[model samples]
Target: MSARRRSISFALFGAALGFATIATGPAKGFDFNIFVDPEDNYIDASAFLARGGFIPVPVIITEPAVDGGFGIIGQFVRTPEHPGDQPPRTMIGIAKTGNGSTAGGILRSGNMRDGSVRYKYGFGAADMTMPIFPFGLDQSVDYHNKNLAGFANMRMRLGESDFWTGPRLIYRQTDVSLGEDADLGPVASRVRDQINNLFDSKQYIALGASLHYDTRNNPLSPTDGINGVLRLDFYDDAFGSDADFRVGQGALASFTPFGEDWSLGILSKYKWTNGDNPFFTLPSVDLRGVQSGRYSGDAAYSTEVELRRQFTPRWAGVVFGGYGESFVSHTKLYDAEGDIWAYGAGVRYKLARKIGLDVGLDLAKGPEESIFYIQFGHAWGRDMD
Candidate 1:
């Protein structure tokens, strides 16, 4: 399946697994005031969670890339033992999309060893159907994918600093086959042969490391500060992988607050790969309106900016735009024909004031399509760790 399908499926599976392990009941005499921020009187979940409440947040996945879907995620957060320590959290849920895709899994994140170390890990399985446009051709072919994947990462904070570094491991096994009813008619034999060769079963194992620096006011959401990461992965036969390749990725995001009611957020990312690797593993231009894997190559880069205005104590509005490109060679990056752009607007609600968490919706338009996303936290906040 395509990259977007895999992402959607894994997200659903992980959430379902996590939710399955959690058991909670309505609190007796649950105080409604806990849902409101004390300082600003805005609706929020900070107090309720701080008071040991478990929240079952509905997951509304509307990205056109995955054909849209819905699910529920149950989140349980534990207060930190110390003032500056990281709070531990568990999340679980499941989801299915209109395209007959489904998944579930569990995730845990927290600090250890007196806040010196942080860890996140999860496992999930998914079955999905996705459309693949081969070799940038307008014609699309359907493919079915079944996969199980897992990953774990551990980072140690540099003593008294904002930097952290860590090792990471990932494993995945996948089976891919052409959709049973797909019709590839009137196509050239060479192109047909290429498509026929794309199906297979594969196992991948990668070992990687990451360097990170963060000074954001809040990890879940941010009004100001900078966060950045650089990571490298090596997938090799020595690691029990079917292919030998190296991948590198880097990303940076910064938020700047202007006065009390305005803020600006900017994000940039770059990824590249070398050596023999599957086409689906190539770097792609990731943007709001573009489907993942629709514009993929050996290297890719993208940047986006958002300007936000706080309309009220509980509501905010934002406008954003981005540009990206994917190219077969780094030397041709500036002149790549795959260059694309997207722009959009959205509104946000302060769902957890104390933690700076926000929920919102956005509608974006790209070169080919318009898409909407039901976003939790920052839209550019994925894989920040």
Candidate 2:
């Protein structure tokens, strides 16, 4: 072949490949999405990085410090070919909120079969404000917390179903600083001292087994299916943990489809810790738009339901309401702020159809405050299930 003829042929071939990719990209479910809060009001902008497969894309984002800023909740994850999954690529990022609270972490994750597995180990630090004094006059306190947490699990398919029985281990070292609060100081100090090593830094190892079942249509945004997890873990000094305790936790979610493109998702979570464990490490009312760990206790449980309707091809509307509370004793359920109620409405845009994931914004009202969330993943969230 002559040099000139070969060069012309190569150019044509390259052009053909580029055109093919552009044609099929949408069908393959790859896209980028961005949005701002107060959808109609346009108060702030929100964006995130979520890519599947192996596309080497570089991203540098700077979010202006306004309306409590933003944080990296969860990033784009790799998709598996079949029921089993694997981890994605190595990732690292940082987040800063508007209320003078900042948090950041680095993660290395993947699944062997190239599926989705919520397995990652990272370190994070946050300076936060908690409304821990529901019975008191202040109703809020400022605290600083730093922690290193890791999730490592190995699973095998069970009985031709998406359910998996696996042994998993969780580790965390939390060092908390409960600073002075003139209004709630005395009571807060007494509560902190009651729990051994609660005010200072503490480390605990959770070694246990989990039975997880997930049949959600989409790992990202499921219009149907059930995802549930039952976990029993133990922390003891024998495991080099500063506190000895037994932790039992379970979370179950089910999405049902009803009238015309409408789906109802119901999710419930329960957690209990027995023994000398740091007060902050227990599970709290993890609801939408609520302050992180705003309500925590030795035992906690909650249930929430969200109804979604596909009003448009790429848009869906969501309305959700839930109630949860944490308490040291059963009688505390009647205490002030013991019963936490939250509800909100939001809009969702199908961010990426391939994974069936949706990006959404919700305006939620907690017990005594209202907040907004720009969700990277579905509200039901990710975990062993």
Candidate 3:
């Protein structure tokens, strides 16, 4: 979808959600969730399985904690079938500063500590965010260890709202591990220059801005809504000059039809890469695709349409199918344009007013994959921005 189209779609989606929340008694409070995704056996070598969610509690400390509230969240998940194995446990400490910027504070798993500050000056016309953190916190499972790692993410926006069209600038540095065990190791091990490469060598710094419009229903408890996000990116490698700072763009559209006893939605994604690109920042959902960063060096797109109708207020049935293809640059990949598709049905169960749990079995290309998806904060593909 074009940026204009995506913006319009998002606006409509947000509006729907807002209307739902206002119409429905305005539910509130914490949410605990868990879900499993299993597509690891795909030949593309990109899929995997995992599950976890936040702890539901009254720890939220801000009004509409859904938006700018802060609290502690704990959860865990596993890959069981990945190249490396380790059941990771996570504990996140969150603190919100305000609503002017999309920034906050985070202390995760003890190894990663980050602080973010966001502010808007000049009558909220200009906005800025600074995120600073130290890595290598998760590498040590035994003793509390320290390592050489640090990076910063900075963005400046000149827009009245977070979703307004504007120019943005970002800078990041990822590879610089010290005193930490090599990835998949406990202590004294090789150092990974970048974090993503620590597990699989893929790292890069991306800088870009986009023009967008977003309108969606209830920021929370959205059963029916719509959203669209469009972005353009320029990526530069901190390690070497592999790609000429590849330029890429992503377009997405999603919507849930209103008032249907059954659910119907459409999600579309399109991404294009310029040159030899780093694998980490590919515009694809992890474990949701056949390959991780599978469409890095070329152009690719995918679209899925789903219809879900509820038999009971707590139970709903859903059916979905879609196709996607990626090429190593339109010309070189001639016969290499890989295609993927899946179709399936599932049951959704709602818990409390803010959470929905779904279990499904999808046939990917031919093989059956089981998936348990969860809904939190907002519906899938919907962003506050």
Candidate 4:
């Protein structure tokens, strides 16, 4: 389906959940929240979950944002198969970021940490940046792109093995357009002359496999344990792709506790993409402080750390900082690099103690600007492990 159609589909799907539970009370296994003008100027009606357990959640938001608008989201977690069954855990969700991003997904896991399966369908704008010619010219063309994708994945725990391996397939269509403020005279002609297939929009497919491991007790807000992943995927003309390419991705996260109420957390990611791939698919830099994606080269790495101390029954304090580097090509990492750094601190409130969920906010400074995030969970993505 077209990217726009998929986005609308996910939005409608999430709304169905909202309609069913709107008149239902909290006793009916539903949780909802409303936040007005939270940073991005949107009235957010949401159903979110933390470590709090299985409950249906729905979220609606009115965003008075720049290049962003209204949206809805729905999410929940439950036991695999049925609520009465035991062991394996599962989560299903659909959401629209209001910045024109939308998606729906389901993930299942083995209680014994033996395996997992994930399926997703999505559409809308991708937070991507480019450093290549024609597409990356700051003075020439500010870029905007929308992507539609469907993905399926499965992983099995190797018998008595600590590692998990799985196969995955991805299909996507992307459309790139020039920003309104673009200037054509200065460098547009040169871009046109140098580029051959960078601007074309088309459908593509990728098939590959992944290996991962995680130990964090609660990856969302890890108080202890570790999380790591290694994955490689390939796409070629044989798969109806406009380009032929391969990508490798990896991440590692660890959390440790000290004393009674203190803990340390660290997260990191690295990516290497090459071949006839689209610019937006390249590795880029994103963390705190950096709002727009700016660095998309052949390789990139980013890392962040946080220190936390629970000071009260329902509150906690934290401080954090991180930096990133992007290389023009997939080198050994340290050799070809452009650095971007950011750091900040924030506080948290235990919104739902049963789930170990804390809702909070943060203000941080990046190399070029500063930003604030109304955090729902950890600012980064980590495996459930």
Candidate 5:
């Protein structure tokens, strides 16, 4: 072939390669959510209720400052809730002081998304030397430490919609402590410290790839419009495991109807662990059922589903229920083996674009007893993707 012909052929080959990569590369999906609370209204209400719920009397509290101080009661009150229409992306609240007075404040979050790559980083800390009244107890303590954390995630899409593929990466860390005057039992205090560190000092790194249909949308909403997500998570350092590994799978689907005024969603998640789960990386509510970390000889699993309905542009509701089970050869918390089933319902009101307010009540049944959970948001996928 002539030199000019050969150059043209080479150019064609390069174009084909580029096209193939674009068609086979992972599809880019992201969670880029943002929220701004103009005032402390929501947090204040949550705190008042948390305090009232714990104790028989109403405990009046003050607003926390925006410094390094914190107010536990106030923070708990200001914590945000999930609504069926949107995702849970951020939190804002006041810090507390040991004197039951306001000290500093806090802001925490991890949310972002752009084309084929998405990332999230969350971190916040506070030392509220404040007083606390444990429900049903008359004693109040004057010391507490706020915990902080952050994580990042990224993904690249694969092939066409007919057969999809991608990879994910994540990292997380946290710390917590009690006030000065209060004295906690050795076990309880240690437990508290451990819980605090779960999201504080510890770092959990994860890497995994997923495959799905081009037609299905990952379950970002409580309702599926004929699309869903089937994801598998593998860990290189599942909670500092490094060489130790664990895996988790999650399925989310949803549907909409009646001119988008109503919808329903379902989520089923299962996780299995091998190796002893790291000492500090078990699983807990703070991590929202996501696989955290573990060592050899340890294993755990969980499954859940949610239903939601939209009544109006500004009004909607959701119901979610699930079961969680776990086991370990030797862990102070899981030695006996246990399972928990939970069910709840909530309502939402959209106050702005992709921003809304939510209130919900959940009842959880376990091997030990029945517990109630009350808070905000629809609690499904949170801030629908």
Candidate 6:
């Protein structure tokens, strides 16, 4: 069987075992009502989860670039210590895709110093087969990669304001090669050699700083206010990197409520890279419809907008559209050939009322194909980054 199929089977088995254990285990005053919404008479897990429940979250991969797959994540959460505080979380997950891509990781996120400081850290490893179309080539080549990576970030609030700044660090080691079954087709021998040389195994370490501002009414389901970030990163031999480069990125999102039932969201982002860098580290046009890395270059920018209508207390609907462009240089962005557009619609169900968290599905149509995504919380959020 394919690795992804095996992963799904194992996830199913684990889910069944988890349910069995919960069914037979002790329940001191625990009742099924904890999983029900008292006001709407609908099924909900907000209360149970808030009370430090352990849940198994299913991972479904529908990215056309990855050929789709499934897996699972096991999560444990601790309730916040005070009102309006974020709950601390710990998670471990593993997944595989039809294209022989596999990944596994463990992550933790929480607040410290009484919410003055926020911290996140994670470690992960992946083996993937990725398609790349270089220099506006119409055809793509498959690149196989094995990587191990880790990152940490800590941000402290700026006194009493809604601003935060911090330092971040990332380390990764990767080995890359042309896929064994890749079809070179009409690609030239010189181009093939160049691609091979650009993908040699290397270790990379980067140090960065970030500035953030957030004034959202609710992070899980923001109906008002703005959130934004600016970041700069340096990767150099002094930091144990095999390549020296610098990257700068910025993003901003705003939410405005039109009434009790309507809300509008807009998000914009831009990224640029300078100095010698690996091909895999280049920026790409990140939009719902575009496959990851499908439109990458030295610089890229994208803007997306979403309109949401709350149909009922428990359900909402949304329509979104976006445009993006990738270019070799800032001066050539206007004339870039890698420009594209996409649009889609989706529905959401309020899964956790207290936390204002919603679960949903989206169907987007990009330049090449239509793809569906299973989403939790805001699709564009970076809270756990």
Name the candidate, 4 or 5, with the larger lDDT value: 4
lDDT of 1 by residue, 223-311 (tens): 78999999998999999998899889999999999999999999999999988776556787888877766777788898999999998
Per-prediction tally of clashes? 12, 11, 24, 8, 65, 0
Query: Per the 3 Å backbone cut-off, how many clashing residue pairs does candidate 4 have?
Result: 8
| TM-score list, all predictions | 0.85, 0.72, 0.46, 0.69, 0.46, 0.87
Best by TM-score: 6
> How far in Å is the alpha carbon of 158 misplaced in model 6?
0.5
Model 2 per-residue lDDT at 256: 97
Candidate 5 error regions (>4 Å): 1-116, 124-149, 159-222, 226-262, 284-297, 309-313, 329-333, 336-339, 353-377, 382-385
| Native-referenced Cα lDDT, model 5 | 0.36
Displacement of residue 104 (Cα, Å) in model 2 is: 2.1
Q: Which sequence of candidate numbers ranks them by lDDT, best first?
A: 6, 1, 2, 4, 5, 3
- The residue-by-residue lDDT of candidate 5 on 1-385, one tens digit each, is 0000000001111121232332232213212111212242111122222232221111112112111222222222222232221122333334333343332223233222322222333344433333332221334433343323333333344422344455555443323345432467888777776655553444446666655442323222223354334544555553463445555544443454544565555544443455434433343321122211211113445455655677754446666666655555544433423345556565544322233333333444433334343333334432122
Report the number of the highest-lDDT candidate. Answer: 6
The models' CA-based lDDT, in order, is 0.73, 0.57, 0.34, 0.55, 0.36, 0.75
Write candidate 2's Cα lDDT for 33-112 as tens digits: 23222233221112222334222222211111122443332334554456424325355545554545554555566554
Quick one: RMSD of model 1?
5.7
Flag the better candidate by lDDT, 2 or 4: 2
Where in model 3 is the C-alpha error above 4 Å?
1-163, 166-203, 220-223, 236-243, 256-260, 279-297, 330-335, 352-379, 382-385
Cα-based lDDT at residue 169, candidate 5: 54
Q: If the candidates were sorted by their TM-score against the true structure, best first, what order would they fall in?
A: 6, 1, 2, 4, 5, 3
| Winner on TM-score (1 vs 4) | 1
Task: Enumerate residue pairs that collide in model 4.
Answer: 45-59, 45-60, 46-58, 46-59, 47-57, 47-58, 51-355, 52-355
